[model samples]
Target chain A: MTNLLKNLATTEVLGINRRNQDYLRPLNSPSAKKIADSKLLTKRILRRSNIQTPELFKVIRTEKQLKYVDWSSLPKSFVIKPNQGSRGRGILIVYGKKKGSEQAWIQSNNQIVRIKDFESHIMQIFEGRFSLGSRRDIALIEERLKTDKLLKKYSYKGVPDIRIIVYNSIPLMAMTRLPTKESNGKANLHAGAICVGIDIGSGITINGIHLKSKSLLSDTYEPIEMTYDQKINLPIKGIEIPNWDEILEIAVKCQRESGLGYAGVDIAIDRDKGPMVFELNARPGLGIQVTNNAGLRFRLERVAGIKVKNTKHAVRIAKNLFGGSVSEEIELLSGRQIANLVEKITLFEKGKYKVKRKRKKLKQGTLLVKGLLDTGLLTSRIDRDTAAKLGFIDAIKSFNSYEIPKVFNSFEEAQAYIDKMDNTISKHEDIVRLAKITEEGKIRVRPVISVNLLIKGIHKNIEVIISTRKELIYPILIGRRELKDFLIDASKTFTR
Target chain B: MILPNLPHGIIVLLLFLPVIATIANFARYVLGIRTLGIYPALSLAFAFLLTGFRYGMIITTLVFAISSLSYSLIKYTRMHYVSKITVIYTANAIFLILAFTLFTQAPFFSNVLNLDFNEINPAGVLLIAVLIDFFVKQTVKKDWFTATRSFIETIIVSSIGFLIIRIPRFDLILVKYAWIIPLLIIVNVIIGQGSNLKLLEILRFKQIIVKPNPQDDKSS
Candidate 1:
């Protein structure tokens, strides 16, 4: 119990009471805070500096003005945000207009919102239903961002945005907020979206936290076991974020421009446009500390009173101070030391079944497979011919015996067929279809198998995705999920 | 420590201190520090009842004017903010003493101000000076612009509180029914829960709330 208290003390998670006494009250100025609190003013200030934000379409200030709004003339996909909105409140996301109906628009949840309901929503916004203190607030209609293609799989319905904490014009820490099925397409940490911590320098994800539990998500996509309860881990960490340098630059500039000594910059990466600043918070919530598994007080104290020349200098200082530490922590947490992108692996079976090689200088089943580490692929993939040589044909036959429903097959027939099959057949019926585009731009969903393979003298149970490597040079591709224990070096061709 | 032989006015004033302190603390905790301005204004009204209106008005005005005026001088100084503030407070104290002596003793000043020195309570003057100094200290810690803005906001909030406390019938009723204090507590608690947005944000954001449909408004 004492140990737990000591750990909690060390974690430096700032509670609301302490945050008010220490961070917010001291650092934040009332005038700059006023700017952050009002989205319209914030946008105006940012736009004057030529910072790119979502394009604003219209704003409804008064009841008369709200009544005068032509709902039909609005874009099919746009966002209605309250000027003084708090958290993720007062933002209505219209996914698109319902087919052939001008009055009906589909919301993020795919609910068909009628024109009357939409107008009433606007009126409610005008009445300050969503704004801070429930005061009357103007609704800002703006362009909704399209989710980046690489991030689409991680998000449920809404766009994934990065929330960066910038203190003294330095991008101190960052978290990538992904909308979960439970969050109802809202990228709010409190609303159940996963907050994955990003290494400030490398932009690689290090740790993730389920906001409510404050539990750490492990390297292998499992939540670290805690005393009270355990949570099912979502695979979030280790993948490198696209446009890392640009994102950090914007966050630092946002703090400097906003006149806020301490600020939280919410940036969303659009598919074509790159990183765009959507919101700024003077009193950014303390949930970021838990997500990063690092105390904000330490980071804030480190940067306090230090003269920052410009945003570029701040970014460089931040990288030097806060970066590289997460990579070391990742090594400790996963029990896997850092490896380069390319590594050499000796592929050998437990015992020799038969000889099927051109070079029979040594034992029959022994082969040296040059492996290239691919973090993008979740499962380790191997050429189909290699699997045949490795005597995995029997396993492949058993894997194929499980009945899979064809695209045009009826649900009832598939269910009936599954019902008629034995428990063993039904148990292994889970289908994972992983699609990837080839070098020639052909999309192929490869066949997968859960097999025991030997790589670098360690026997690992890995799901191997089978693909025809007729045109490929290397026969084996080691994915991130199986590389937890091994570090790869691209320079070394075949090092055990 | 209850002295039954004490005068009614002293006892009432003693009881008022704790209740007023509680109210000030409530304002600080729930509504943020900027709302601390309301306390001195409310205190002015009570001071009027306790030590007469003339003395209370004089102290309030003296504090507000001195604090607001100090901003212009403080801006150009290179001294540390704490040292600067201490200098301002010392100047305010000297000015108050000079003003009091001139108002009472000097025939020219006495004629211009037209006030009776005998009616002013020394305790009320001391209380007002301390409260205003504290308010100034809080306001001036911020940047010049924010300090000025909050300083004005504090005065506005105080004036509103003073006005509410000065209602002739309400003042009498409040003194008679101290039970209303608990009701005010409940009201404040509810307001604390509700006032999550800054008042400035509501006003500033109104500029961007444009009318979307010109034809619909013209028809109306």
Candidate 2:
């Protein structure tokens, strides 16, 4: 229980209760929710603001309108949904009129939806079964926008939408909800769609999670490389979403126009219409955080008090803080652990580092210490205190008794000191390798011992020079020699 | 501490509802298990209280079974929604009556005559009325699978509620201090105060939670 709470704090995982009390209830105004509840009202608001959204074809508010409506004049493809539907419920996508039947249409699921089926569905919507609190609602029909080819290839039959969670006009975190066969042509995580995390700086997708309908418990989601379709064997990992900057701009603008302090704006790409705003959720789903492998609380706390001039500036600020795919790329490809410049790593005792034991297997005592991923040095180094704690007592005692000079003013002086002490200190049985070192104007022979270290999640058996860099703050310094698997990004500090 | 002849169990129902609803809420918010709803569970529990557990359970099971059966039989027919609901309810009455008759006549259930269906108080009738409201909605809106799922969840919650009501210690304490009912606001306040992480969400967001934390080791 304590570990769970610690992990929650470490990752800053936001729960439903916390999200509602902290974010939604405080950040979202009642009017914002009022508009969000009514799809027609949201569309009108977004359209009036000149934000791009799918055009509204017709709205069936009364039974009389349904009776008098001309069925043939409707567009070839359109979407009919309840004005107050939640979680993508009570939505019907019509591909076109069915062959040889004027009153019939082909649905996204390839089922023939006749006029009777359509009317009955509208009547059901009017019956208030789909709306929250089961209140009576009208049906809003919008022109069905085709998924751009990039997203179309990934979807089975449904259109995909990118949800950008904007807080204080800054697009903080984003994930694209890709429709799957399991989702039944609906792009909802609960309905079994895949959520792929997108880099806030560049709209490139990273790792994703899929909640298959069989695993409806919401806790049991599978990490996925690609969508459910076997036809498209390509992974959806690095697909760059088109119009990403524009999408962010519009999403932030939508939040601004709606007077919502925090909101999730759904954007779908049409082959012609470009990126169109689909829906604005006053309370966005918390699953996006899991998809992004980021905690909303952590991100929210970051941009809480920052001021932005406009949507453009906010997008830039968001990109600058949360962008970059360095560690994400490594994780996506190989599932290797990600580390920052400074990290806490686990180190084991000297002989227990990685030595093979023929018998008498014993547990190695481990200690947590700070490490620096320095790019300048070729060989990694550990301090004397850290070495002694890791059972390198003999090596530390031997090096300490050598009476090494404290400071060498000249290069020749340091080289002479190193040449004199080489054979004596180098002959130590514990010293695995010898390496020259020059720092400031001082040069000293440091013992390189092989130590077992756990960085991020990867375990390494690497040689490190033992030195008392009393001036340095970190007990350990990891050089380029041990950082072969990771890419260094100076902008990032700590990754959890 | 016993009540002074409160007519119908509504007053008693009111007194006990806060505790039962909070239990349902805790099951939902903390444990991530959901019942049909809080009100329905409360009604079922009170119904169980007045009618006695054994007969109440049997009748509840029959009501759900008959509700499912009647809806399936008439669903394909060209009948209006209201008419369909009325027909299913009529079928429910007939089935319950027939089951009661069989229970009275069967040698195995010869003592069922003492189950006291006739002596049921007005509270029992009101509780059944509330339970029937869900039945009516199920017939109009839900399929057999979802209706059955809700029925089972409701039964589980109602059973817990029934057990709470059966405990005489709580009844004595609560009836003597009936003002304790309003004190559920404190419980509601504690529960309503969101923002603290929910227990179930810890498992739901396990990935984020368990993600390794790299200390902000800013040392050189």
Candidate 3:
């Protein structure tokens, strides 16, 4: 407990309560909070000053508008928003017109949206289901921006928005939010979007902090350096966000125009229109601190009373004073790589021989003493002895029935041995698949069983090829499926 | 130590208010328990204090079951928010009063020591009924698990308040010392300006705290 307190104090991470009381309450006026609470109000305030915002299509405040509105007259692609929704609630995205349907559109998940769906959704808005403090709110439709070309490759389904924290017209900290498929394309951190910290000066993305995608570790969040798909080639780090300066300028303009002393401005880039202001938040989340691995309190305190000449001047001052080390940020982002050749890995097995329907499953198995992080291999391999020890005795029992050939066997011989098995052999609950391997100058047939890997509290279900590796040192070998999470480094002790 | 001028109700209510607030703060910051804000918890605690323990539990449980049923029935209706809540609360109130009538007349009650329905304050009953609003809103917006968790936490915190008030002469002690009420204001300020990480948030921001994972780097 003492260690937790000392580390937290040293990090100077601000809590939600403190953010509201000390910074938001004292700094922001009640009228400013009122403006920030309503998206339409903030957009109107900014659009009056000629700042770029998504053009509003329509507003629905009553059932009359919701019922009589022409669905066909609407654009093929647009977004529905509750004017006072918090944390991206009561927001719906229509992808495009469905095939052969006059009044229906497709959603991000390919669900059909018709007049009835639209009516009920807007009815909820009228009922104040998603509004702040359960007050009745107006619903609006705005043009949906396509994910920019540079960021499209990193995001899964929707556009990625950058959240900038501005104080006294100067941008202090920023983080890019990517909409993953798991988040239903909302880009809400609570809804499972990827949040990566961005350097205020360079606009280069650092590490991303997102919820682990496994249900077994449902409430656990971890730092990641890869895209949602865990694609190695599409790394999340070091990607230059397009239109950095314009986004910062627009954020500053929004903060100044909205009359918010300290504000959070969300800006998303359109593939064609460039950076456009999405919305403004009066009291933003403190997750940016964890993403940046820096304390917001320290940064806010450092420039609390400084004077700025103009928007450009404020941006310049921020770049000079509050900017972090760009090189260190890049290195730190890349450090999620598990660098060791042989590392300890935990495997989870079924507690019972046959898991009944809806039963408590996955008794965590004994930690594999040593696992080889073999990058050259495409699929993970586990020695037969280790697999049996990890509760895959059924696969070993079936393998033992096959007679052992003394002579060096060929690939066809191993394939023939697997092909001769009866239908019951493939029905083993532990066995995921079968694979043919050429090892030690001969052919080896192994069963690929499903196993859960728990590394640094990140849970993943990976297939391991059960092989006879009694002579080998390491019992298990992890392959390139998740090899991106690990990196080869010279020394294990790379203290930040 | 009883004050001669003030009614016992007001005096006890005043004493219990600060204790309930302190309990709520302790629950929120130190234990990381979230209830339906603080107002619902405060009133519910007072109601529990007025009705005693077993009766309080019975009434709260009845409210939870009846209010949820009423909400599920009225949610899809074409009524406005205020009217829908009014309908649900009316249904709850009808059943609550009917249950009291049955309990007062039941033959088994006399064997266990009969409960006097007239003794329970009408204000206390109204206070407990206000929790139905939180339940309806939670069901409308959030999932059952979250709504149920908040309700349970609220009940637990209120029960703590009731238990504190139940202690022999707990109110007399407060009446003897009048400074404790204003002193609680300082406690609230400290809680508001608190710098340390909350117990729940420590786990939430675990990514920020650098863990020196003594790496055993021996590889053959």
Candidate 4:
């Protein structure tokens, strides 16, 4: 009991309540919500920005419209839904018109529905039976999405779709709702469907959790162990969603165009059309936290109020900062952590003062340098004369036995060196190997030395090639290969 | 002029707080005003107006003090929520009966304390008792410290409203033009529509508005 309580207190469990109280209620204005909750409005807004939505066959706004509707002209497979419906209620999926009966249709659950049934359903919709608070509503018949081959296995019969919770234009979390026999062919979790959490960065499903049987008492209530059926196990995780980039792009676009600060964007991949957004919900349920096995509050809080320029920028920030397992994989493969483009590095000089340069020695030095970290360079570099003064001459000489190159303080001097070198070193293999082009177009055979650096209290051993400081403003330059543990922030300069 | 001895001015002003509070509660319901420690201020004001400030203050203070004390003690006793609330209210009822008896007889200076058992309306006491019970029960649902803080805040808000209604000039204006009371509805509507950001949200999102120098947009 105590353990369950403790887990409930964790951010993942409490995030739902916190997000509702803070983010959803505050960020999503009531007017913005009208746009999301109404399917017609959502489609109109999303369509304006070129975001694809399932084609609308017809909208039955009145009982008279329902009576006059040409039943035979409707698509072989279409979805009938109430404009203000929620939790998959008031949704009737017609697989196809029953064999020879022109008015009869077969639902995903295998229930036969005649034209009269659809009329009654549309009448109920007009009467607001399934609308929010049972207010009057319209009914829409949309083209039913053909489930992608990869997703068909997880669902029982109904087509599963991706639900992404977007906050502040950032897609925070995603999950796929799979239909189950227990749910009567509906992909609604409360009806016993399985919800599979998907990693936002990788687009791969992570874990599965089902809604527990509601028949049990409160004290006995617990989410049941997920199983494929009464016997076999379903492989719910590791399902790779195709066109995940498009899915994320459309979800963010929906949020941006809807003018909702927080939104839940539902998208489905059609067999041929790729991804199409189906709905946008302003007050999206927090069941996604349980489905994702991660908290939404922290991710939403992390991205809140940060200015995002476009969908790409928002998606990149979300993936890089809160990408979950994908980031861990990158760190594992690179054998290093990712950092910013600029970093602070402390440069070490003499004990008190020494024009010291030795081949090898154990020395403690001081001289903090704000190094401009660049990944383009193959090796780290520093000013030649400054390196020699810092006692790196011996180490450099021992590494390659190269004599000190003449220091050029001006661009003209470096340009002069490049002209002279073009005649000699440009033609010879060994000479060319010894010389490398600088940012200023000059060439030099600078020696390399391994030095210790202390950045933000982390000690690092980096090998820097010696170069002339004449053209560069920064004396020390740290390259990508040398930056392993440190995260560079280009916005930040040297802090000592 | 029709009822000169009735002190119609004070009576009309006494009605102002409840009317304003009713409008405020309606605003709370429709617009979702979630600022803390403000909901029951009107009931407290009504309680104070029905009985003089001293008696009203005594009942509110005693109910809150006793109920909150019992609430904190009963929390560790392993009872269900309904049963625990029952225990706190029962303790409060017993304390109220005992305190009322003691206040009527204890002659510190009779002039200062206006409470008399014979004149005290049982219905008024019951209403105050119920409000106290609800105030404690609702606030304690969150946490002990919150319950205690809200109890004090509720009383403080009621006392301020009570003092405002007592002002002579304000009382005269309300009685002279009872039609002016409808203006409060318009005032509340404007107040609700004007500010979308709550008091706390303004402070919370202050950093977004007071931006630093525009040089570093990339770094967090």
Give the range where candidate 1 chain B is weakest over 10 consecutive residues by summed lDDT: B211-220
In the range A1-496, model 3's lDDT, one tens digit per residue, is 6676667656556676667777898888989999999988988888898888888899888988787787778889999989999878788899899999888899888999887887878887887878888898899998988889888887868788999999878898899988877777768776778899887766888767886642211246688877756233377778888878888888888999999999999999998889888888998888887777766766777777888889888877676555534544444778754345666666656443332325434443545456777877889888776777777897779656656453336777766766775344567767766677766656766678887666544566788888775576777788988777666432322211
User: DockQ rank, highest first?
Assistant: 2, 3, 1, 4
CAPRI tier of model 2? acceptable
Question: Which of the CAPRI classes, incorrect, acceptable, medium or high, describes model 1?
Answer: incorrect
Instruction: Report chain B TM per candidate.
Output: 0.64, 0.76, 0.82, 0.70
Top candidate, metric TM-score: 2
Over the stretch A303-342, how does candidate 1's per-residue lDDT look in tens digits? 7787988777787777767765455665677777556465
Per-prediction tally of clashes: 5, 2, 1, 4
TM-score-wise, the better of 2 and 4 is: 2
**TM-score preference between candidates 1 and 4, better one:** 4
Residue by residue across A246-303, what tens digits does model 4's lDDT show? 7888888999899888888998888888899888888887667655545555566567
Order of models, best lDDT first: 2, 3, 4, 1
Per-residue CA lDDT of candidate 2, range A22-92, in tens? 88888888998998778888888998889888888889999889887777888988988999987787788
Which portions of model 2 show Cα errors greater than 4 Å? Answer: A8-11, A212-219, A324-326, A331-496, B1-13, B28-34, B65-91, B105-129, B132-153, B212-220
Off by over 4 Å in 1: A4-18, A211-234, A333-496, B1-220
Error of 4 at A75 (Å): 1.5
Q: Give the runs in model 4 whose Cα sits over 4 Å from its true position.
A: A1-21, A215-227, A230-234, A326-391, A397-449, A453-496, B1-220
- C-alpha positional error of residue A443 in candidate 4 after TM-score superposition, expressed in Å: 17
